[model samples]
Target chain A: MSLLEVRNLKHKFRDGTEALRGVSFKVNSGDFIILAGKNGSGKTVLIRHLNGLYIPSEGEIFFEGKPIHKQIKWVRQNIGMVFQDADSQIVSQTVWNDTAFGPENLRLPKADIEKRVSNALLAVGMMELKDHSPHNLSGGEKRKLAIAGILAMDPRIIILDEPFTNLDYTGIIDILGQIVKLHKSGHTIICVTHEIEKVLYHSNRLIIMDRGLIAEDTLPEKGIFNTHKYGITPPMEEREGIEIVRDMTWLK
Target chain B: MAEITVFHFQAGNTLIYRLNTKLKLLLLLIYSFSIYQLSLKGVLFLSAFIFIAVSGTLTKPAGLIRQMKGFIFILILIVAASMTSVTGDPLFTGLPFPTREGLLSGMLAGWRFVMIIILGLIFTTTTRPNQIHAAVGEILKPFPLVNESAIAARMSLTIMFIPILMDMLNEIREARKARYIEGSRNPVKNISTITVPLISGVILRAGETSMAMESRLYSGALPGTKQAVQRKEYLLFAACLVPVVPAFLL
Candidate 1:
């Protein structure tokens, strides 16, 4: 049975702008889903609904067998979201305080909060910088700390919105490796991004949105995400490119 | 406030900054009490109070005094109001105004007001809001009732916003000044002219801040580690109260 499900979900902004128009999808436990789209495609809007940050104007979201609206806190406790901007996500002055934020909310005892915070920090390899202020952290470290903040929450499903937006080459590889480990740990994951070139291979399911609607939903395969469909320039079609090699390995 | 904030806080050192915020706030309480007692000494004590405030870490006391210049005008008006014909003696020796005793008392009241203002300026410049919030949580921790972390978080954010809001107000003023907004003194017209833009700016900034906070997952639980030194710090805070009590009692 699917661990999480969304059916015909829709959202409209207060300004009378329709941001998401009747999107639908589902993921069983341990499934890796990639939500893709162009700018203003409602990808972030859709992911936000999964975490109950925004309620759908239409359709239903189910966690396990329960509807999302009926169990908002329960849903949040299970689904962790990592937003695009690293700076905005951090709430504490110091890295230690930020990591402790999630567990502290849970009202756990001091020892438990300490252990979980330590474990979470260790997971992201940020234990060394625990005393450093979050503002002083490098871009990659900030992103990692943001992820660790969610990991401390111990969510069953982690949804990342444009997680690789500002990362350097090495940072991107490091984060991707962490995401793969998360998947291997039997946690369901959803990664949303417009640039599928980097993360297409890591996902078990691919969802594309266009103009507030789901454009495509499929498995990772060649000829998928073709720029020609969107009326944009196509790739070089270099068969020996790393992208091609990644796609081949991913599909296999 | 911005001028004072820029001058008082050094780039380094947490000795004054690290004490949990609530304790610093309690110190403000002690300072207020001390100032209230000093009112008996009249303007002489008030001048001494200002001297002590200037002696503190604030690098630009003159900037702070300048910020209070507008308030000083208001204080004069208050003193004048108290010295009206029904209440106090007038220095001008008018038929319908101030008794000799009332005029003297009004002057003393104004002096007390200045002392209070300077004390506030000192406290506001010296303390960070986060420490205060944490101190409040520490004080309440024994009960195990409220969510200390959330309270601390809100207090810190609110304190930080005061200076930010002041800057926003100044920006609005500058924008209005560009269009000659200060010509009218009529209250209703002035409010309508200034408030419409201010309210809209506040709403826009508030939405942006909230979105930024939510994106960061601010709704999550508080940190698990209560720094070991917080208890020792609390003792030091209690010690800070010792010096002020005797001063106030005298």
Candidate 2:
């Protein structure tokens, strides 16, 4: 059995608009799925459903062969989501406070919470600013703090929506490396982005969404064609002088 | 982004900075309500002491005065009004409006308010918001019929989001400027454009905050992390009272 399976998921907003028509997919352990789509293409809406943030209008989602709705708390505990907007996801004052929020919510022991928060901040290279206020952080720092907040929860499946948004070049490299590291460390990841080229070489599978439907679900090599048709920019062809490095690794 | 440090926390590791947050929070509440009892001279002494000691966390005296110039302006207005309205012995030979007693009274009242504000600055600059949040939870635990953790969580978030909302408003202003629609002769029209977007954005932010909280498994109560009050907290509390009690007595 697959780790997570979505069956014909559908959702309609109160404004008479369907955000997700009928989407289905299965995610296995250690799969790094890159969800790519244009604006208003239901990529975000679909990922939100995976973590039980939104109830599907008509369909069932299962985790480990059990219905998600029956045990959404478990689903949420297992699937951590980093939102597209870093500012929106930030609900705490300090870096350490925000990072500890997830573990604290689980009512873990004080020692456990502290160790988890410290490790998470260390993982994201934010331990130096542990006591600093979250609002004063730069865009890239805020993004990293958001990721650390989810990391403290130690979820098995991590979902990132436009994680590269508003990041500088170094920030992009740093975050992409972190995502790849998470995948290599046995955490399943689903990263949604329009900037496919930055993450294409790292992701194993590609899932494209268009008009609230899964336009294509295939390997990254084959799905490059599907991205362009769905209004996403395909990875640039190797320049005349520069060579593509297929064996490039982003570890550490 | 604008960075205002009037009441914002600054990280430090000085001896005073290491004071327990519970001690600072308790002192803050006590001084806030009891400032009127302190003599004007005592208030002045306390303010000067805070200015000198908190140089590590807060700006210098001159910088603080500059940042609080508007407040000083209000104080001047109050003194001027008292001089003109009250009947007292004149300070100058020919200036009957400038009375010494009215000036003293005005200064006394104004300094009371200023002293409380300065104490608040001291409290915030030394203590982290999370520390204050936890302290508030500890303080509210004794009271019945109150969800201490929930209220503490709300209060902390409210304090932290002030700068964020300010940033959002600044973004809206910049966006307006970029579109070249920021300059309207009609004050109402100009204010409306900013106000409409700000209110809507705040509403959207409120929704987002709730979803974020929910996603993190927040179940109407924060996790318990309270520890035993230390001997140093008690010592600090007593050390603070020793100065203030004598200030009121003498």
Candidate 3:
């Protein structure tokens, strides 16, 4: 069963610009769906609607069959969104403080907040930078910190918008590895990005959004349109995805 | 306890900085109220405040002076204006501006303003924003209507960001300058462009910060039980009001 359902989602800005036009899609838990679109294609507007960042101008968004509007905060607690800009997502002075933001907002006990913050930082390999000022962090570190902030909330579904932007090869690998880990660990992941190569490697399903509509949705193995080059760079040598873990942690 | 920065508070250990924020807050009120009430005693107290502020400058006098110059100028202006009309007495009233009553009143006003400035600077410079916010949260915990921690956090943010805002303003000014020729002068247009971008930029930055804060779980509440704690500290705080009572009565 789908964990999230968007039925005929439409969003129009106050200036009368229709950013999303009847976009609809769904994903079950543990499914990594890539939302691909060109600039101004309503990728962001559609994702923002899922978390009540912007209410749909029309149609409905459901989290496990429950209407999004009915319980905005509760639904938001289950869905974590990482915006395109790291600067926009990071508000705290320290890295740990920034990571602890979402869980703190959830009014978790102080000790739990601290634990989640540490665990989240550990998950992103940012524990060493916990005390550093977020503004002083490098671009990749800031991205990881942003993800860590969401992870601290322990959201079941993580939505990332252009997660690979401003990242180098190593940074890209680090983040993608974490995304795969998150998906494998039972979290539904919906990422909006045009970087088809990374999406193809990391995502089980692909949902291409064009002008706020789901232009194409298919499994990675289906080879829709033979856009292999457009998809993610396949692993250098696949060992059932075990090499990624070994390479990342240097485990036997 | 004070940091090297003029208005920025230091977080590390220091006896004066470590004193209860509520106590410092009370001292500020008492200090201001005493100066507001005019008598020989009040004048002496105000003079002592000036001396302390002046002595503080010995370590980095220029910083303190630079911080005070704007307020000093305004105070000087107020005193000068009042001096002109202090006609009942001949003390410092020889100029067209000075009168006996106006001179006395202006001097008192000037002294009061200075005292308030010095005390305020000391508190702000010595206290960290986090501590201030935490103290505010602790103090306001009693009132059901207020979320003290959030208020404290916001207070900290305002304290921390004011300088950042000022820096952004300076950047905006510099940007405006670069747009124009070296010797050309168009203050009105220059100010328009400068102010417009500064306001917009600050607003946008503020919106982003608020969103970030909101996303992190800053529901703007003090992060503890709403149940009121024992009233001992509050009682002591209220008791600190004794000094101000006499001033107000007088």
Error of 3 at B244 (Å): 15
Every model's TM-score: 0.65, 0.85, 0.68
**Tens digits of per-residue lDDT for model 3 on A88-197?**
68655567766876886787898898899999999999998876656556778888898899999888999998989988877787778878788887888998877666
DockQ of each: 0.12, 0.50, 0.17
Taking the tens digit of each residue's C-alpha lDDT, what string does model 1 give over B34-104? 66565464346445645764565465677666755546667987688767633544546546566676677
Which CAPRI tier for candidate 2?
medium
Q: Candidates 2 and 3: which is better by lDDT?
A: 2
Q: lDDT of model 2 at residue A180?
A: 84
A248: Cα error in model 1, Å: 9.9
Clashes of 2: 0
Query: Which prediction has more favorable TM-score, 1 or 3?
Result: 3
- Top candidate by TM-score: 2
Candidate 2 lDDT over B1-250, as tens digits, reads 2354445566667656777777777777776665777777677666665666667555444454454443665777777777776668988888877788888887777777677767776776677777777888998999999999889888777766665666667688789899888887888988888889989999998888778778888887775455466898688678766666656664
Across residues A103-167, which tens digit of lDDT does each residue of candidate 1 receive? 76666787887898899899988898886656556678888988898888789999888888888
Chain A TM-score, prediction 2 = 0.93
Better of 1 and 2 by lDDT: 2
What is each candidate's fraction of native interface contacts (fnat)? 0.12, 0.57, 0.24
Whole-model lDDT per candidate: 0.68, 0.80, 0.69
